[model samples]
Target: MLDFTKSSAPAFQNLTPAQFAEGRQQPGAVLLDVRRPDEFAAGHLPGAFNLDVTASDFGPRVAALDKTRPTYVYCRSGARSASAAGQLATAGFAQVANLLGGVLDWPGALTTK
Candidate 1:
């Protein structure tokens, strides 16, 4: 479990694209794409679920996730996922990892749906 109380603010691990990819493969890990619906529809990491950080229900939506499981978050650039990761940590998520450079720097193949 992560020690979210150690600092004034919650901290989330920032993983490189390759590292993020490996983490995504872990059993029961959730790959969350905190991008807008349009952006998510264009292209996203395989198996990533769309959860727009800008949505009005962002907090509620995030709260609905399984906090015990590890969550891997990403966005167009890194900003949104960073914010989302912090939010998840604040929400008592045990494990949270943010993609360092987001999809822009992701080396893995993306899926459009």
Candidate 2:
């Protein structure tokens, strides 16, 4: 029952495709694609960093990021990224945003792999 949504400045927010696109434009945004490497190789948002949420190294990789930064995460259709977003929130990321519909509902063209 850590209600991140109740905070005045919520630590975690599930965003619509539009909100996600706009928010990631802010300076210092960290975009994380929490999908398999092959899935990422197929296509992803520009500047996305690939890191498998299911991979054994997921925890370590996530730890390498600056916890105080604004972190946005996505997967093919949201499920995986939602989990990752929760993890990010629990791990003390200052701002953790999950793309609601993932890449399937992305507002812009994915970078060709």
What residue pairs clash in candidate 2, if any at all? none
The C-alpha stretches of model 2 lying farther than 4 A from their native spots are 1-11
- Best candidate per lDDT, number? 1
Tell me the tens digit of each residue's lDDT in model 2 across 70-99: 999999999999999988887778999999
For candidate 1, give the lDDT: 0.93
For model 1, how does the per-residue alpha-carbon lDDT over 28-100 read when each residue is reduced to its tens digit? 9999999999999999998889999999999999998899999999999999999999999999999999999
TM-score of each: 0.92, 0.88
Compute the lDDT of residue 63 as modeled in candidate 1. Answer: 90
The TM-score, computed over Cα atoms with residue i paired to residue i, of candidate 2 is 0.88
Residue 108 alpha-carbon offset, candidate 1, angstroms? 1.4
- How high is the lDDT of residue 39 in model 1? 94
Candidate 1 positional error at 91, Å: 0.3
